[model samples]
Target: MAELWKSLPSWVRNIVVPVLVLVLAWNLVWFVVGVVSSLLGLLIKGLVVVGLAAAVVVLVKKAAKS
Candidate 1:
């Protein structure tokens, strides 16, 4: 791998390596953002479902008392 890198021209090593590194870093950040956003969405959906379930239970109890 060292030998292969050595064979490449200086300009490619300088420019392409930095660009590739920046792309990898950018992708990593987006990956984390995507994961966080997905988890947040799931949490919101779960909360909504729970809220609906609680509402139904309360209505059922009120009807039973009547």
Candidate 2:
């Protein structure tokens, strides 16, 4: 194993390191965007549900008072 590692060319190592780093950075960015968008969607849906529930309660109270 040590010999295999030792035999790897310096040029290959230099190229591979930057390529791997870019791939990792891209994946991290993708994950963050996915998480943020999903959270935003959930928040919007929750707000809509809460608004509808409040409207229903208001209508029911008004009907009962009449």
Candidate 3:
């Protein structure tokens, strides 16, 4: 593997290799961001649902007390 890499031309080694690495890295970063964004969205939705449920319970208890 090392031998093959070393055998590559200077332009390929210096330019093509770094460009490919950057592209791969950029894709990976976006993938991670997408995953995290989805998770956060779900979390926020879950919290909102829980909050609404709690509010309903509180309101029902107050009405029953009356």
- Model 2 residue 42 CA deviation (Å) reads 1.0
lDDT against true structure, model 1: 0.99
lDDT of 2 at 20: 88
Kindly list the per-residue Cα lDDT of model 3 for residues 1-66, writing each as its tens digit. 999999999999999999999999999999999999999999999999999999999999999999
- The estimated TM-scores of all candidates read 0.87, 0.78, 0.90
Clashes of each: 0, 0, 0
Which regions in candidate 2 have their CA more than 4 angstroms from the true location? 1-8
> Over the stretch 1-66, how does candidate 2's per-residue lDDT look in tens digits?
878767889876689868988999999999999999999999999999999999999999999999
Q: Which lDDT values do the candidates have, in the order given?
A: 0.99, 0.93, 1.00
Candidate 1 structure quality by residue, lDDT tens digits, 4-61:
9999999999999999999999999999999999999999999999999999999999
Candidate 1 positional error at 4, Å: 1.2
Highest-TM-score candidate:
3
Clash pairs (backbone) in predicted model 1: none
Give the Cα error of residue 2 in candidate 2, in Å: 13
